[model samples]
Target: MEPHLPTTIQISAPQHAANNPYRVIEGEEVLSVAFREFVLTAVAAGWKEPEVALTLADIADDYVMALARRAAAN
Candidate 1:
C-alpha cells in the first residue's frame, strides 16, 4: 500500500457546526473510510464540534497504530 497522508477535515465554524459545510479530503482509502464512519456516527448522534474533533483524532491515532502494526508484519 502507498504511504497514506492524514485526512483533512476543516471545521469552519464551531458554534454552529453542521454536517453540511465541512470540508473533508481523505488522502488515503482506509483513512477516508474510517473518517467517514466517524463523521457519520457523530452526525447521527448530534455531536458538537469539540466532541467530534476528539473522536476523529482518536480514530486517526488508532488508525496510524494499526497501520504501523501491519507494516511491521510485512
Candidate 2:
C-alpha cells in the first residue's frame, strides 16, 4: 500500500490590536512556512501521517502558548 501523505496544511496568523487585547483579526497566512518546515522535518524523521496529526493536536495548546509568549516578547 502506498503511504498516505498529506498535500496541504492550513496555518493562520492573527492580527491583534496593541491597545486592546480583545481586538483581533484572523485568516492570515502567517505561519505557513514554519508549519510546513516542521511537518517536513517530522516526516523525514519517519513519523507517520496519523501519528503526526495526533501528536500535533496533542501539543497544540502548548504550541499556542509558546507562540503567545513569543508574541508578547516582540
Candidate 3:
C-alpha cells in the first residue's frame, strides 16, 4: 500500500474573546486538524472511492466538533 499523506485544516482564532472564552485560549486547538489528517491519510491509502472518502471526512468532522465542544466545556 502507498503511504498516506496528511492534510491540514486552518481554523483561525475567533474574535470577541469575552463572548467566547474557549476561543481565546484554545483557539485553533479546538479544531482537530489531526482528525482531518486521518481522513486524508485513509483516502490516500487505497480508499480512493468517493463514498468512502466522504464517510471518513464526516467522521473527521464529527471529531472536530466534539473536540471543540469539549474544549468549550472546560
Candidate 4:
C-alpha cells in the first residue's frame, strides 16, 4: 500500500492543558508537528541542535527499519 500524506491536518487539543495533554497526529503532520515539538523540547533542555537532529534521524531510521522488517516477516 502507498503512503498517504494529507495536505491539511486537524488537531483537537484538550479543553484543559493540565489534563488530556496528548493529541492524535496523523499523516505527514506527524513528521512536522512531532519533530518540531521534540526538537524544541530537547533544545530547551540544553541539547545541542546537531545532536538533536541526529537523534531524530536515527529514530526515524529505526522506525523505517522496523516497518520494513515487519512487512518482510508478513
Query: Which candidate gets the maximum TM-score versus the true structure?
Result: 4
- Backbone clash tally for model 4? 0
Model 4: lowest-lDDT 10 consecutive positions: 19-28
- Those runs of model 3 whose alpha carbons end farther than 4 Å from true positions after fitting are 1-48
Clash tally, candidates in order = 0, 0, 0, 0
- 2 or 3, which is superior by TM-score? 2
User: lDDT: which candidate is best?
Assistant: 2
Order of the predicted models by lDDT, top scorer first: 2, 3, 4, 1
Is 1 or 4 the stronger prediction by lDDT?
Answer: 4
TM-scores, all candidates, are 0.42, 0.44, 0.37, 0.59
lDDT of 1 by residue, 1-74 (tens): 34444445543333323463432332344456656776766655567867888877898799999999999999
| lDDT (Cα, tens digit) per residue for candidate 2, span 1-74 | 45666565545445665665544323233565656677786777688877887888779978999999999999
Angstrom error at residue 43, model 4: 0.3
Stretches of candidate 1 above 4 Å error?
1-45
TM-score of 1: 0.42
The CA lDDT at 35 in model 1 is: 66
Residue 39: error of model 4 in Å? Answer: 0.4
**lDDT for each residue of candidate 4 in 1-74, tens digit (9 for 90 to 100):** 34443333334444444443343223345557756776776776678989999988899899999999999999
> Model 3 compared with the native: what TM-score?
0.37
TM-score of 4: 0.59
